[model samples]
Target: MTKKYAIIDTGGKQLRVEPGRFYDIHPFTSMGLNFLKPNTKISLCRVLLICEGSNINLGHPWIRNAIVRGRVLHPCFDKKKIIAKIDSKHKTRKELGYRQNLIRFIVDSIWSNGKELVS
Candidate 1:
């Protein structure tokens, strides 16, 4: 069987996603995925490209009926990043830390034109 994958636009980023795999993405309000409980079913419709077997479908912007179905695994925070600054002349020091909110999900399948491309 040919391995299938797709390029999807979400959370202001393009990601290559495959079925039955887990992926982490920044939480975005536009997708209305924030605050979702675990195991919640979701369908992402902004597929930019899809490849199945030897057939590839490239959308001008987005395929008319192409959608990727998945379920939310859970919500989590990414690794913390620390930032530090120091000024000798000013005799000042500062430090900051940040952790981005992220959501993990498993891609169950990819579909295009009413056909299941990947399972």
Candidate 2:
């Protein structure tokens, strides 16, 4: 059987999510990061689109009453990147590192068009 899925945008990034799967995503908002601890469950209402066996619902930006229920699996840091630059003639060198703050989530259910599907 084919499972349904949805596309969602959070923290300025787009993600394809399916039920019963875990995805590491950016914190939904800057301030929301401060209060959301691990194991907290949240309802994401920013559903861009939903598809189930070719039955698709397109939204004008987002669908009304479409929500994805997920649990915060953990709060962690994402990948780290190192940037380095060197100038041979001027004898200048610079190095910098960047890491993104993120949260891991387990999708529990998808509610679309007044119907709920368990993941």
Give the best candidate by TM-score.
Answer: 1
Q: Estimate the overall C-alpha local distance difference test score of candidate 2.
A: 0.87
Task: Write the residue-wise lDDT of candidate 2 on 52-80 in tens digits.
Answer: 87688889999999999989988889889
Which regions of candidate 1 are displaced past 4 Å? 30-34
Q: What lDDT tens digits, residue by residue, belong to model 1 across residues 17-117?
A: 99989999877685555558799888999999998778788998988899999999999889999999999999999999999889999999998889987
Top candidate when judged by lDDT against the true structure? 1
Report the backbone clash tally of model 2: 0
RMSD from true fold, candidate 2: 1.6
Q: Pull out the clashing pairs in model 1.
A: none
- lDDT score for residue 33 of model 2: 76
Tell me which residue pairs clash in candidate 2.
Answer: none
Q: Give the root-mean-square deviation of each candidate in angstroms.
A: 1.7, 1.6
TM-score of each: 0.90, 0.90
Candidate 2 stretches greater than 4 Å from native: 30-32
